[model samples]
Target: MRKLISESFFFCSFFSLFAAFSPMTIHAAVKVPVQQMGNKTVATAIGATRCLTPAMKSLHAQTVKQMEKDMAQVDAVVYAKAIETYQKKLSMIWSAMSEPYCGYGSRGMTAVKSSFNKSVNRMRAEFLAVTKTAPVAKK
Candidate 1:
């Protein structure tokens, strides 16, 4: 009996240690459709634009132009493939963020709106800082 108890204790300890060290995976609370996520992203971007100052908007345009130029340097096919992958990853992120309120109704929608506003505010601050210190292109 004592031997059996010792073996059981050892097994429990080993299992507990293994579990403690195991990697944890996080999952989204709800599964949002890709189409819905896309729509939400577009709406969010449009709403966010309203919060940007004129200078920030100009900076954003310049940044986008520079990015497009940089992308153009890459092979067309390769850039297209990369963009596809990027879009897929972005969609996944948006879906995850939208998961919580997927079908919850008005309260869930309110939560989503609150979350998007918070995210937009954070992004706006970051963009403002970037625009303020970004270097001007030499003619």
Candidate 2:
């Protein structure tokens, strides 16, 4: 009886300690409602466009010039590829952000938003990269 009790206590203590030191994920506090998510997407897209405005201008000028020229297929191809990547990233951002968690809604939303932001940032970066403008360079 004494040995069994001691063994049980040891096992319980070991489990407790293991749980205490185990890696746990902390969630975000922001809970974006579903309707709000759409608004957020639109707002973020607008913000992204505004943020990339100068770069967009440069790209527009370059693209116009390229369009006027007969041998700008490479530029078109590059633009298409970059745009495709940006679209894919945008989709990923939305898909990841749309996960719904009952108890961890806020945390999940935060994680999703963070992921979405990263994807948007990457897409913006790719746009700027293709445009080759320094105006949108990170601060």
Candidate 3:
């Protein structure tokens, strides 16, 4: 009985040491909460969005690329018309590269429009996933 107890105690001590020294699990912090993301979508999307007359083909390409990423974050249809107006400003600028211009400035702007849809859809999916998950899973 004495030998058996000592053996069990030794095993328990080894197990405890191993467990204490094991690699820890880490969790990443969420950047935005689901509840707040919807509110920020439009604001963040258009934050840096603007159009400038094409200085050169390269500059025009870069500016428009950044602006599209910004504008594609709108979450509602009410703002879509405003986006359309901003985008419309581009049409007048291209003919005169030296002239500064304003707006999203596209005739069709299909790519920005598509990215906007993609962002909204992805947000919806993420929100849905969070809503469907277990409310109280222990760490």
What TM-score does each of the candidates earn? 0.27, 0.31, 0.29
Could you give candidate 2's per-residue lDDT for residues 13-64 as a string of tens digits? 9998887666551223334333356447432221122112354335435543
Compose the digit string of candidate 3's lDDT tens values, residues 57-89.
555565466547656655335345445544555
Which candidate leads the pack in lDDT?
2
- Better model by TM-score: candidate 1 vs candidate 3: 3
Model 3 CA deviation exceeding 4 Å by range = 1-55, 98-139
Model 1 agreement with the true structure over 42-128: per-residue lDDT tens digits: 323211222233543454455446445544555555346454543454344345443433333456445544554454445444434
Range of the 10 consecutive residues with the lowest summed lDDT in candidate 3: 25-34
Name model 1 segments beyond 4 Å from true: 1-93, 98-106, 136-139
Off by over 4 Å in 2: 1-78, 100-111, 133-139
**Where does candidate 1 clash, by residue pair?**
none
Count clashing residue pairs per candidate: 0, 1, 6
With candidate 2 superimposed using the best TM-score fit, by how many Å does residue 103's alpha carbon deviate from the native?
12
How far is 32's C-alpha from truth in model 2 (Å)? 25
Judged by whole-model lDDT over C-alpha atoms, candidate 1 comes out at: 0.48
